[model samples]
Target: MLLHIQFSPEPIPAALPALSLGSETGAFVEFRGFVRGEEGDHTIGGLVYETYQPMAEREITRIAEALVVDHPVQAVRILHRLGPVPVGEAAICLGVAARHRAEAFAFLASFMDRLKKDVPIWKTDTLPAA
Candidate 1:
């Protein structure tokens, strides 16, 4: 399996790296986690995310790697933005390529759920809507 992770201070890019897939890769799934206009019951402009960098990356990698035991994942790519992110902008982007759609979907769902609970990434602050 191919695993790739990237972090940036700038806004998450609109274009993503192509996942290298072979003929056996029949399904490719992509997900983008965007900053919403609201946080909890309050309105907001954006959010600032913080992470320990090394540990965050390592933990997320572990989560992805562990999911491989059940999913026929061919390639996994993740991109996360650090620092301030505006509303409607992407904070995270993930791609999963697998031999079948079922595995890809399951892997994506499980990975996201695990990431929210396990990863050290957090919303350090919120931007006031202007």
Candidate 2:
């Protein structure tokens, strides 16, 4: 699924139950990234994420499509939260449905790794008072 690049004030859950696949899909893999409370000894009050909308969306879509071609993924959903995000809240969620558990697991991992390195998204941390 293609997603919109926008900011939200709502907290993102660690697990998104709403993102699921049917029985026809033998395996379902989900990846969720949370905001860390600390970064290099700096207390993280929150995170500010920014994305180049057009390029970010395009790159994500391309990655999803490539996963489908390379793996047995039947359906995929990639969701990323923008703006201020607090610790323990989800920053990103990726769901993958495939014919086998192994493929689903591997593809999900690769997707997240690639998205982080390739997608046009940047993050800045808001540090708390030292």
Candidate 3:
């Protein structure tokens, strides 16, 4: 499952049952991205994420397809947020499920890494200009 990218000051969705317990698979893994307190030499008060929607979605779909083809994972769900996000809030969330624990873990890790490196999302700090 994929989500429509959104930008809101409100908290991210609390219920991700489709990712957690929707599948009958024996294993599930989740990855969550949050706002950090620092970025490079700058202190981050918040973050703003922007994406070229069409391109970003396409890239994400490609990654998901690759994961299913290359891994034993049974299903995958990815969600990402945009706009102003404060510290401790989730920027992205990923979930993978499989029949075994090992595959679930491995696929989740790989997906996270690939998303960070390949996804078209861009982030900018909301810190005050020096």
Candidate 4:
């Protein structure tokens, strides 16, 4: 199994991520989370995210590994943008590859659920629209 997890201050690239897939691989799934125009009841301009880097990466790695074997996943990649993320732009991306579609989707779902609860990445609302 392969795993790549990262946090960056730059905007996420628009191109899709690539994984070394063998003939046995039959499915690839991806997800992107964007900053919405509204947060709660207020119109939002953007969002600012913060993290401690090392500890956050460690926790994220642990969360992903726990589901890998059970989901029978082959490769996984994650990217989260720090600092400010503008509305309608992607703040995070996730990719998973597996030998079957069900496994790939399952792994994606499980990983996302765990990430929200366990990760230390924090988000603060940016300037509200005037």
Deviating ranges (above 4 Å) for candidate 4: none
lDDT of 4 by residue, 52-118 (tens): 7898889878987789768988999999999988888899999998988898899999999998888
Higher-lDDT candidate of 1 and 4 = 1
Report the C-alpha lDDT of model 3 over 54-90, residue by residue, as the tens digit.
8878887787777766677777777778777776789
Q: How high is each candidate's TM-score?
A: 0.94, 0.83, 0.81, 0.93
Can you list the residue pairs that collide in candidate 4? none
Span of 10 residues, lowest total lDDT, candidate 1? 11-20
Question: Clashes in model 3: which pairs?
Answer: none
Question: Pick by lDDT: which candidate is best?
Answer: 1
Error of 3 at 112 (Å): 1.4
Query: Residues 77-101, candidate 2, lDDT per residue (tens digit)?
Result: 7677887777777888777777788
Candidate 1 lDDT tens digits, 1-130: 8988888888777887656576888888999999999999999999999998899889988998899998878999888898999999999999998888899999999999999999999899999999
Candidate 2 vs candidate 4: the lDDT winner is 4
TM-score of candidate 4 on Cα atoms, chains taken together: 0.93
Model 3, C-alpha of 13: deviation from truth (Å) = 2.7
Better of 1 and 3 by lDDT: 1
- What ordering of candidates by TM-score runs from best to worst? 1, 4, 2, 3
